[model samples]
Target: MKKKTFVLVVIALVSVGFSAMGQRVDRTNFKAGIHGGVPFGDISDHSNFELGLDVGYHIALSELIDTGLTTGFMNAFINNDSVDAGPVTVEGDFPNIQYVPVAAVFRLYPTYDFKLGADVGYAVGINDGNTGGGYLRPIIGVNVSGNTELNISYVKVSDDYDFSMAALGILFLF
Candidate 1:
């Protein structure tokens, strides 16, 4: 069921993306891109890094203002090699987690092929092989081109889990 929902969401997004690009191909100057980067931070008291990839699409609403969507997936893993692993580390389950974030972005100054933006959204995570709780994230980023960007963000998770992360990445546009 969840897999089906995820697939449907991807398909719908792709359809909308194609139609949107077709509509903007002549007068709107639309730009769609993807990015990949490493996530640096601690989640749920586990000090592990995450690897992630994201996609975004933008249409010039004006010379300096544009609205778009950003979607991403990340995998986080924690290593427990010590005999005295933390209390949170238990048997029969591991600490590998996955997160998917979908957001709406408002961008400024994308014409120089470099841009800065703010993002507001929620992230859904799967933990220990089960769907976990959600989070709220506030993000800021710089796009050096349609294909490259760097971002920093703060994510707030339930029950006092929180952290900040920085990502350096490249995006491809078509």
Candidate 2:
């Protein structure tokens, strides 16, 4: 009975020690990655592809879990000619709009080379061309190495058209 009590005491002490050091552990746990990929969607009839770039930082929340902040840039192309102006074909320039997406991200690393996660955030449209409203993105990726990953995701935007985009890219983690 005494032996059992001693073991329990040791386990309790160890658990307390770990919890106390949790902050320290997180303080030293950090990661970053850069990814760029071609996004595909119905933004334009002849757009073909668009460029995307993402840079983010990760804070280790647990052994297999992490939470952090992410910001990304997307050069979105869309065909404006679809909006036919009555009788005349309006020759309006189709500008590539820049999109900046910022979010609070959470990740779950299931394997050494794989991670699955989701992010909730907003996509702010740059330039006066188009102002997209709020956005929600669900992300999935595979880590190529300790500091690199490839990701694919779907982003839903709050707009009159309710636009959505599919993003695919590779990120270099730092």
Candidate 3:
């Protein structure tokens, strides 16, 4: 089922990754990105906005590909506070939903200015009642300047329920 699909995809990506190892290797670079998003799925009931910061170190696997490791913090701002318990009115408070993601990055360039990628890993929940989740983010990026890229992605974190978001981000590579 889902687990099998995940494993298959990972295997495919790794095979593709190894193919590029024989080509070229660029200097290791660091990247930082800022992202703003709209949360949906189960998280939408509690949060409306998501803000994230991503930092990574990467080296080109080939002229057309790059592989790296990325880690980031993402916070989903809580908007819901209280809920009704049948005839009783209940007032409660919960902290904002937050996750720290440690992931692997893979990017393929079709041209100098455009690329496609995905980050796959675990999102460790830092808020109450939440443990962690499997994380996946597929992205489309365009080079906006010398070392800057503008990207859009869909982020999904799956635990007991799915936490999904759509985000727009800007990345600076150095």
| Error at 91, model 2, angstroms | 3.0
Which regions in candidate 3 have their CA more than 4 angstroms from the true location?
A: 1-25, 83-90
Task: Encode model 1's per-residue lDDT on 87-114: one tens digit a residue.
Answer: 6645544556667766555667745655
Give one digit per residue, the lDDT tens place, for model 3 in 1-174.
976686566556555545544455546678998999999987787788999999986669767878877889999998867744469766789788789987778989999899999998778888898877778999999999989999999999887877899999999988
TM-score-superior candidate, 1 or 3: 3
The model with the greatest lDDT is 3
Task: Estimate the overall C-alpha local distance difference test score of candidate 1.
Answer: 0.53
List model 2 lDDT by residue over 1-174, tens digit each.
643564465345434434544544544333444433344433544354556667665666677776666677767565454444458565666677567876666678897677788765666788576775555778888877666677888876654444566777777755
Ranking by TM-score: 3, 2, 1
Ranking by lDDT: 3, 2, 1
- Give the winner by lDDT: 2 or 3: 3
lDDT of 3 at 53: 98
lDDT of each: 0.53, 0.62, 0.83
CA lDDT, candidate 3, residue 155: 97
